[model samples]
Structure formats: structure tokens, C-alpha cells
Target: MLLLNNHTMKSKIEKSTFIVKLTAVLVVLMISIISCNKELTDRKDFSNNTGGNVIDAQQQKVLYVIVDGARGESVFKSSTPNLSKMIKNGMFTINAVSDENGLSATSWADMLTGVDKTKHKVISEDFSNNKLTDYPMFFKRVKDNTSLRTAAFSISPALSTKLVTHADVNTSLPNDEAVKTATLAELANNNAAVVLAEFQGVDKAGAQYGYDASVPQYAAAITNIDTYIGELNTAIKARPNFSKENWLIVIASNKGGDYPVIPALMDQTLYSKPLLNGFVILYNPNFKSTIYNKPANLNSLPYLGSYGKLNGDTIASVDAAKSNLYNFGTTGEYTVEFKLKVQSFGTLNAPIFFKTSSPANAATGWWIIHNGSNGTWRLGGLASAAISTPTTKAMEVNQWYNIGFKIYFVGTVRYVQLYQDGDPIGSPTVITGRTVNNSEPLVAGYRSGFGNSATQFITDIRIFNAAVPDAVIKDFACQVLLDSRHPNYNNLIGYWPALDGAGTLIKDQSKSKNDFVFQKSTQWLSFEDYDNKFCIKPTPELYKIVPRGIDIPRFILGWLNINATGFNLDGKVWTPIYTNILK
Candidate 1:
């Protein structure tokens, strides 16, 4: 049986005490999660991102819904018309992970902190075990930075008191209907920037009967919650200034239930919640219902990939015109980055990067040339090139790598630091020549290298005037926040995203004069497919119990009818699976 939340067991008991006092312990834990965690001693108001005096931008708001014990399978399989509509019009992933600890407390901790139970330290219901100081909740992150108001509403009293922290308004009520009413009332009163709402009846019913939807009480609970969800949606849309407010409605489940056993021998309790990756959806009118999925042949490392693909044909070049963009004057401290995959080092693969006195003469040019005598990356020169000391793991071909080069000068000697996929390669190369001249054009792709080491794709190419630290370079390798949004953007001289898939002029996102010209269009082509890069998506949980066809009222013509907008979950035209259109 799988363990939930990856928490360490306190030495397996000869037998569990669950059968004796399960109800009492569960009730206690639930109450503790809601009311027990103490206030962090070092709590501070979130730092302001902007002044209150400035005309506020079109406000963004969130209606965060936590549906307890609503297994991933029940969402689409059972009748959740409202949720189904939201999934169709927004971004959703049924693969959101719950902490391996399987308890409501563990799941709640992760939901708040965006961390595993180990980091949040909420393995059980003991609030004293919470380490919110280090791993603060997302609500705190929101409240601290923006002028936007935030609130938390929950049917469980302890949730608003114990689990939730730092909100402008918080209300704990008795039931789902009450919570929904309060949320709606608040929306009408003042447009709260954020509202985190929780419904507990589903879990309460699951505990009373069985969590599987086949169990009448559990399915009934789910149906009732769907009704409340519809009401909440109506309230959100019915607000006076709804059009001006961009609302993000998110629905997520905590732990799963113990119904619909996958296999008889699998110890359903331990495996149930862990197997369910859980359901989560971010619904917004502007959201394109695209679901990101991992590639079939994905490696362990995940990347958001470049802004677009940079097709590297041997003939093209991105010449940084003499705008002094690439010139690392006298101090000679600069960093250049590229996520690249070399197809083949043909007969003459000499230079991958160059800024020289001239192209033909070898007098002075800074080069990170590929294909040295040892096939090791090196600082290129005519003869005395300093190759990487030696690496058992040299640059492999055909695989993508985030390569960074830091060049600096001390006295007359030039120092070159090589970072292959964010790690320092071998040792820093010490070269004697320092090309202090800012005369030559900064040329990429068509270098005077020995062989034709054509780049298959060059994405996220960034050049900085100052030497960037190894830590920042490592961090940037995995992040795709892009040029201006990047923490190091101000110093970033040139950033050419070759991933637009359909561009002749490679736009320099850094807004510098350095842009590239496409020569022989047929030789290279930008590819927009993300299937090549590893996807960052939740794990899919696909087990559920669907009740028999009850033929419940579908609300075909009224506001309850999801098809009134004719939008499918993928935002395609709504079409019933069966031939009968008048279902």
C-alpha cells in the first residue's frame, strides 16, 4: 500500500487503533486543522507593490473553492454539471497532488503553503507542528503585496480560525448553504480581491456512508455541493461590476475518499487518496482551456521551454549591430546564455559565439568555440585554445542543454568560466588574450569554427553586459519568465527568443538594437510544438464510482444550462456524445 504525504510512519503499529476511536480522532484532527495553528511570531504585513493613490488597474479577484474528499474520478464521471462547465471554459488538471500523508490536515497544509507536508510540517492536526514561518501560505503572499482585500469563508469553523491566516475578512459558518450565502453577500457588499471558500459536507457524508459515489449518501452530498457551486457562480456573475472584475474561480479537492477500490488487496485507505491526484481547475473567461501534459519521452528535468523555437540553419546569423550591446569594454565582465541542441559538428565547427577585431584575421575575437581536438568546449583561439580540463560527462549531442559562458578580465589575462546545463564545467579556462576593442559585430550562428556544428535549436539566448552570478544563471536555466520580467532584465543587453516559430526578424525582447536577419528562409524553420519539452502537469488520478443514470433535471433552457454559451470544456462548440441532441 502507498503512503500519503511521504510522511515517515512512527514505526508501524502491530495494529491500527483506527477501528476503535477513528471518529473521535478524525473529528479532533479536523477541528485542529481549522483552529489550532498559532500565529507566526514574525508575521508582517505584505510589502506593497504599488501606491493606493494610483488609479487601480482593472481588479483581479479569485473565488477559491476547496471541495473536501471529492475524488478526481467523481468530478467528470459523476454529475457535476457546474464544475464540468467551469472545466470546459478554463484550465484544469485532475492530476493535482495531495500530500502523501492522506489526512485532511496534510492536504490542507499543502493547499495553503504550496509545499509538501514535510516542509509545511503539518503531518497530522497538531497546529504547533506547523512551520508557516518558513513556508508561508499563498494568501499571505497576496495580502502582503497588493492593496486588494482578501477573505476566507468556510463551513468548518476551525478552517477560518486555525488554518487560514492574514485575510481582510474571515467568516466561519454552519453549512454549505450558509457559506455560499455569505460569499455571495460579500461579493455584493464589496468586491473582495480574493475569497477562499471551503465545503465540508462531502467529506462528512463520505465518513457517514462510504466515499464512493455508488454510495447513495456520498453521491447525494456531491450533488448538493454542485448546487451550491452553481449558486456561488451565479452570485459571482451577478455582481454589479462583474464585467470589470477579472475573476479566477478555482476548484480543488483535498484528499480523496475510500470508495471504488482499485484492487481488493491494495489497502484502499492508504492507497485511495494518494492514487487520486485530485481535481483542480482555474476558471477565467480569458483562460484558454489548454491542459499541459508531460512529453512521452520526458527526462527528469522539466522546463517551460523558450518563448518559441529558434531554428538554427547553418546560413543565418543574429548580428548585434555595433550598438555596443555585446562590447564588454575594459573590465571585460559579461555573460551569455543559450538553450541549444547541436545536430552535428560538421567538417568545420569553429565558433558558436564571436566578437572579434575582424572575421578573417585571428588577431582578437572572444569565442566559445565547439569541437576542440578533444571535442571538449573551450575558449577558441587559433592554436593555444584553453579546452575544458576534462569531464567524464562531456557535452552530449542531440540533447538540449542550458549553456552559460561568463567572460571576465584581470590584468592582461582573460578568464572564461563555462557552465554546461548550469553546472561549472571542469575548471575556469585561463587565456592570455583579452580583446578590449568594441569594433567587431557580435555575430551568432555563422562563426569561423573548424566544422559545421549546426545548432538544431537555439532558444532563450541572453547576453548581459555584466558577469551574472552562477546562481542566477542556474536559476534562469529552468525559468521562462522572459527578458523584461526576468530578475536580471535591466542588465540583460540582448535577448533573442527564437521560438516564435514564424518570424523572419528575430525580435530582441530586451528592446536593444540587436536583432537578427533571416537568410535562406527554407534552411531553418521555427517550431512551436511544446511536446518536445517536458511538461509540468499534475499526476492523473483516474479511479471513481459513477451512480446509475438518474435522469436528474438538466436545466436545459435556464441560466443553469451550461450549453447556453455553447462552450465545451476545451472551449469548442458544445456537442452531446449521443446522437440525440435533445438529451
Candidate 2:
């Protein structure tokens, strides 16, 4: 669905460009409005400007809870009524991320230190050689700036011992129940301005069983934490100064466990890693519901299809009748293109794609082949002919490359052009007198004697009757799948994606209906096209809106109306709700 046709895609880009320009102007106006009203009263009015509740910074308290290994998808699937209520009353997102490293030590530091693993150096469980002193926990920031009472409760002793520095009351308990009991006790008796707690039951359950909601133990553990959350919320509400206090309840996961997500939930990027998947909720009575959902990207269709890894043992071919139009005779003009990733340099003159009875230079045929001399490809035909030429540049192994060639006639003069990634490889070589037409079927992957030692991957075969222009080839070189954007769309006589996933017949998408049939067992391969160089930008809808653990400290600072710029924190405020509150 993300692969819109050329016209639709162009229209979308134009509209998106205008909206971005408009958003830029609006952002300037919003900044001006914020700067003009720097007072707390004016900021409070600004919070309610969009009809949200009036929130006083002085009365704000935070109860930030971190649950380990709670996959956001699993949490969404589980029955957590308490969390659902908070989601309705908060700025929340199921598509939030943790530190990419996905280690407890790393994400814990990310949540507490307001920085990534690269800055904090807490990449392992032992907390060895960390830079915690330079970027100490947020509790230290609060202690240095204000006299506010801060408390930290955790089931992991290392968190209380290693990371929870400068908290007025820091305690490590044995289990989730003990942690919850101590947190409930603190809320009932003490008036802590910030209370941070960590629970480990979900992570423990995930480690024992699995991280999916289908696992009874994992689902039960999540519901159990929800129960504890319910109890904690009850205690907070029962406080004597409840009506006067404005509380910000923050619930989040340090990281997700190692489990494959369902296809429906897969983002098909680095963000789709199970360990990087987590959730964040910044709940307050005054805030309006704002949820950041997963955005659709250009990878929505995901170039997921069958690829061929020819290791000298497999060959695919089209019948001569079906492949006759593909042969560039003395008079005809044609183009051939395909994607290739060389696993290793093959035998001297390995036939990658050819249309002939023999692959010898003296044979009356043409081939797109690997030249063992310089680890590059060359055009092969009758010996000492213009149709035989080697590419100037060598191709690297294990990297995807778009390889193409076109033969056309300008007046009575004929020329053969080579292309690598859609750019002409040197200048065109004249082959006016060379005749490469053959009666043999068009063959790929293997031919007698020339392909036995070859190893490479091949897919997305395209054959056009018209000699395509250089501009059009370069424009669609990185395209994973062809569409109407191609100027020679109607001229394609053969188009085999070679991605049937499980079949001997490589389906043809072109109007000519010429399909390539495998002569032997095809070595089908699977890969993700997430790293396509063509459409590299992520979809704009939720680009930077998804929250992260590093943002927790900045969120706290913003809620408390504290200036975070002086702290040199490496995080942004979690939501736009706190934008006007930041000094």
C-alpha cells in the first residue's frame, strides 16, 4: 500500500512539502507565543489554551514506574484496565522505543541518566567502567536544584546501589510484591515530590517462558503488575492533600524481550527489534489524550520476495519462443536489467545471463557475465567484436547492485551501453556489425562449463523492447519493485521478479507474460529491503514523536518547570503538552 504509483506519489510529495512549510511557520508562531508568556500563570493558561485542564507546576508530583521486558504489543494485547484508564488520560504511545542496545543496564541508565549508552557507558549488567559520575542519575539533578523529596524503589539491588544516587530515600527490595509494598508505604506516609519504582516480574516471566501475550505466565505477570499499579494509584488518591496535588503518573518499559512480533505489529526497521520495542505513558488528570501510533513507511509493502542464490548448481531459463524478443539482433534495440549481489567471484567467464547455445567468445551469442580477471562484469559475444567489453570499475562482493545493459541504433550506427546502478559504465561501444541473435533459449544462473563455480544472488529481472534512456534507468535503479514510474513500462517484454517464495516458476509481471522456469531446484532466499537507498527517509507521520527511555528525565524536568538546558541532558520532553512549560 505504501508503493503508490508515480503520479500519486508525486502528488503526495507536493502536498507533504507544502504542509511541512506550513508547519515550519506554525512552529515559529508557537515558539513566539511561548517566549512571550514566561510566567508560571501564563504557562498554565497556555496549557489550557487548547481546552485541556489547567495544571499548576508547583503542585505537580511524579510517580514514574519502569517495568522490564514488557513488550508493547503484549501489553496492548493483555487485559490491563488500569493502564487503559491512564492511556485515556495521558500522552501515550505503544510504539515507543528503548535504547537500541536493549540491555537492562543500558536502558536503566538511559531512563535515569537522560543519555544513551554511548554517553553513560552502562552497556552491561555488571555496570563496569561506567561514566555514571559524569552523567549521574536525574535524582542528583533534582537534589542539586531543589529541596524536593525524591524516593526510588527497585526490585534489583544493583539499581539502588549503582544508579539511584542522591535520592532522599532509596531502597532495594527482594521482589515485585516487596517493591510495591514499600512504594505503597512511601505514598501513604511520605510526601515525596518524585517517586521512581522498578518492577522485574514481567522480565523474569519472559525469561522463563516467552515475551508474547500467548504465554500465560507472561500475560499473568503483566496483569499482576497492573494490580500493583491499581493499588499504588489507590494509595496516591487517598493521600490527605490529594485534591491540592496534581500528579503525573508515568508508566514505561525498559525494553522488550526477545520474541518475534506478529507481522501486523512489525515496523520492518531497526525499531522492529523485539528488544527495542517498549511503551511510554505520561499520565496527568489535566492532560488530553494524545497517542503516537506507528507510522506507515515506504517499506509498508516491504520488498520481501524470493531471491535466487545460484551456486553453480541451479539454472533458470525461458523457452526460446518466449525469449525471442529479448535477443538484440542486428536491427532490434533492447535493454536487460537485474539486481545482483556477488557472494564470491566465480569461474573465469561465468554466465550470469545469456541467450545462446554456447558461452565461448567465438560462439554466435551474447552474455552478461562475471569476468574473473578484475572481479567485474562484461559483455560477451563473438571474439574481437564491439559487443565484448569489460567494465572499468570492479564491483564489491556481498553488496546489492543494479546491473543493466542496452543496445540501440542511432541512424544506421549501432551501440551497446553497459550500466551499473543505472549509470553508464564508461561510454557506449559501437557494435553496428555485430550480430548476437541466437535460437537458444534465454538462460540465467548456469550454462555448461562457465557457471559451475559461480556463487551469487539474482532477482528482479527486466527486459524491455525499447532501449531505455539513461535518465529513466538511474531514476528507478534503487526501486525494489517496478511500477508506472518507469518510462519504458509498456515496452517490458519480460519481467520476472523471481520471488515466488516457493516455486519453480518465476512469475512475470510484464504484459508479455514471459515467465522464467527453473531447470533445477531453485535456492530461494529471503531478505528485507529496509536498507534501500532510494527511499531512505522515514514516513513523516510519527518520525520523532515516539517516546524513549532517555526522554524520562527531561519529561520530569519539564513537568517540574525546571530549566533542563543547563543540565546538558541528551533527551527531549516526551510530549508537546510540556513544550510550553519548558523554560
Candidate 3:
């Protein structure tokens, strides 16, 4: 009986061991199946299917609209239903600012060329020199792509000559009615890669009649423009080709005009009111969050990032750095902050200061900041160190820092704070009894003195109309330290007026001097018959005939040489170079 019981126990133990081994095998098989399924799903989503039709590159198109003089503030007040709807549905830049030059021709030229006026050498309406004419105009660079059609219509006479002379297609009609017709016709063609439209009657009227008299005309023009813009939007929506993956439309204003003057003048000189110039708005439907993930090796040095529009031909690093300097307005409180990554601490004790360009008094509208004599940050309105802290902590190299200020009621201010890696430095110090003056341009990246420079990586820099809440400020600092995205960062780079097929930077070569040359060429000469004697002259006027034997640059020639490799517009990359530049 004892032997029988031992055998039964042994058999049960073996069965239990077998059951445990089987369970382990099943678990491993389930995990393997899940892992394979995940890999397959990812491949299916991104991989190009062999049976699907490949999209031809020539079918891509972009619409770019530049309103000659529209203020960021006035966009909401202007009763532009179409623009407002687009802004809400797509993307809108609330604090979009333009560069220094307020002139339409200069600003538009910068927009089209992406090169500074100094490079393009086209500054104002009176500019007649064709020295830079041969440089490939923006459209000329992409015109050869057979699938890519290009056209531009401008209501401003200031732009008419330049457009006809430089653009790939001169489609400007005499009046607003003609502009609508041409714009619609281009839309119907379905082959165009880019279409640029400019409206300037309001600007002309504003310049002629005073701001008040021109208000109605401006309002009327905006209404008409809104109607047409809506029509275009509707037409594009109706087309099968108009998908998020295929088409993009950009709407923006070249600059803002100044009217209803406000006492507060912060960087108003760039586009002062009664003429407020530098307001620009952008809308892109295809934008994704990844666009702001600062591209690898994107130089963070001042002026190395996207250079804003500024005066002068060649904008040096200093000029680029100086572009962000702004002043406090007369009435409201203003705040400015810089997100910088420092490398090493130098002998410079006072790394930051604020002061006016001139002595702070009742009248001047400019102010500046710099290092103070007492080893502290100084406020422009106050004589002594407004915020004092020991400079004992060694500055960490390649780490982000935040320099912020809160200015109350013109010059009556609170305190400024400096944070290194999200922690406030030492203590919060205060300043008392100072008048707000706007005599000097506000500056950063150096001491209060002229040209006290520093090499730092700056990003997500911002200026606010109201004092930033401490909680929001802390979150901002934390995000910067963690390398997280902020609303303002999106406002800075992602909300561009236009974008390429990849939904990255604006694809229009016009924004950069990609295909155009700014040098003199016979092809750019304007001809006139003086008493039946035809004479060619270098002028801003348009030429009807293409000049023969014009010397094309090596880069352009290289593009032309490769035009036969199924790479030219006809094969895939629809562009206008053959018709506009090569001709």
C-alpha cells in the first residue's frame, strides 16, 4: 500500500511541472506576436505602397498674399471675415513684427528675395539701377518646371515696374477687377506652383488723403480683398488636388501703417504709427508641431537664425542682434525676456543693464539696459544699481539663462530678474522714483554701453504687453531647461506665412536670393524709342523682348544642365526658371 501511494504522488508532480513549462512558452509567443504586429503597423503607415499612385511634384502649388499696409492690431478690427476665419481655422501670429525699413518696395523686395535690400539693391520706387537685375528673380528660379505655373498681380504702381521686370509672369491688370480676373484664371489653370497677389490701393489712398479720409477706402478695399480671398479659398477646397498633403496658401501684410497715435512707442521707428509699418500675419494649414523642433546644427548665434527684415543692404551680426531691441511705451507696462544659453563667465561683472539712449527725462521714447558700476544690473530710468546680486556663482557654459524685466506705467517700474538654469539669482532688488523715457533703443546680449558684446545661444526670446505671471514664468523657465516647446516658440517659427511641401520653412525661393542675381545684364535693360531711334537704358521699366546671349551664372547653368535629367519642371520639379531666367 505504501509503494502505491508514492507512485501516485510522483505522477501528479510530473504533470504539474509540465503544465508550468507550457504556460511559459505561451507567454513568450504572445509577446513576440505583439512586437511583430507593432512593427508591421508602423511600416504600413509610412511606407510607400507599390500599387498606389505616386504624386508628381509638378502638381504642387502655393498661393502667397501680401497686404501692403496692414497692422497686426487692425486685423481684428478691419472686418475681414475671410482673413479672420482663416486666422482662427489655420494659424495666426498675434505679435508678428516686420523689420526696420517701413517702405513697401523695400519690405516687399526683402519678402520676395529673402535677401536684404543691400544684396538685391532695390530699395525704393525711385530705384532705377539694374545692376542686380540679372540675379535670378524669385520666380525665375522655379519657372522651368513644366508642371509649375507662376503668376503675380499687384495693385500698387510701386510694385508694377519691379514685378514686370523681375517676376516670372507679369499678370498685373489695370484695376482691382482685373486683379480678381487674373487671380481666378491662375487658380483655374491648375498647373501653377505659386501665385503671389499684392493689394496697395489703400496704401496709396492713405498716403494721399490723411489717415481719416483714407479709412473708408481702406475698409472698402479690405472688404473686396476678403471676398476674393474667400472665393479662392472655396475654389481650392472644391478641387481634388487641394489636400493637406498637396496645397498651401499664405496670407500676410508687408507692413502696418500708423494712425490713432499711441504714446507708447516700442520699436515704432521700424514702422511708426500714423504709419505703423512692420506688422506681418501668416497662415499655413499644413503646419505640424515637429516644424519647431530646432533643426540639427541650426546655428543659434545672433543673426545666424532666421534674420528678420532690417534696413541697410548687408545686415551684420550686430545689426541682426540689435533688431530685437525694443522700448517701453508711455502708458502701459512692458516686459522683455531673453532665453540665453551661456558658455563661460568673463571679467564682465554686470552682464545686463537697461537705460535710455539719451538721459531719461520726460520726453525721450527710447531706453537701454547695461552693466552698472556697482557690479549689478542697472535700469535706464534709475541712476544706481536697480538689481544688485553678488556675481560669485561661476556662469555655466552651454546652459540656458533667462533675463526678464517688468516695467510699470512708462518708467515707473518694479524689478528685473536674472535666472540661470531656472533658479533666481541671489535676491529680488527694487528701484524707486524714475521717469519713463523712450529716448534710447532697448538692447540686450551686451552691457548698457555701446558694443559690449557677448556670444550666447538665444531662443524663445519674448516681449509681453502685460507682466507675465510668476507661475507662467516658472513654467517658461522649466520648459526652456527641459528643451520643451512653448506657445511663443510656435509663434516665432512655426507660424510662417508660407511653407514648402514638407511643411517646413517657406519654400518660395523668392524669400532667398536662390536663383536671382543682382548684377547688371543686357537682359534687364529697358528700351525706349526716342523719335523712332530705339535706345536701351538701365531703368526700372519692363522690357518686352528677351535679350540674347546673356551670361548665366554657373549655379544657374548647372541647374539648366541638369534640366534634362527628369529633374527639371517638365519631369518632376515644376519650376519657372526656363521661361523667366533662361530665356
- Considering every candidate listed, which one attains the maximal TM-score? 2
* Per-residue lDDT of candidate 1, residues 332-376 (tens digit): 578888876655544444455566543333545555655542345
Question: Which residue runs does candidate 2 get wrong by more than 4 Å?
Answer: 1-54, 262-267, 298-543, 576-583
Better of 2 and 3 by lDDT: 2
What is residue 332's positional error in candidate 1, in angstroms?
4.5
lDDT of 2 by residue, 197-298 (tens): 999999999999999899999999999999999898998999988877778889999999999767875553656777777888888765667788765662
Could you tell me how far off, in angstroms, the CA of residue 358 lies in candidate 3 after the best superposition?
Answer: 36
| Top lDDT hit | 2
Model 2 clash pairs are 306-499
Instruction: List TM-score per model, in order.
Output: 0.47, 0.55, 0.41
Clashes of 1: 25
For model 2, where is the 10-residue window of minimal lDDT?
A: 43-52
Error of 3 at 47 (Å): 22
Q: Which model, 1 or 2, shows the larger lDDT?
A: 2
Worst 10 residues of 1 by lDDT: 547-556
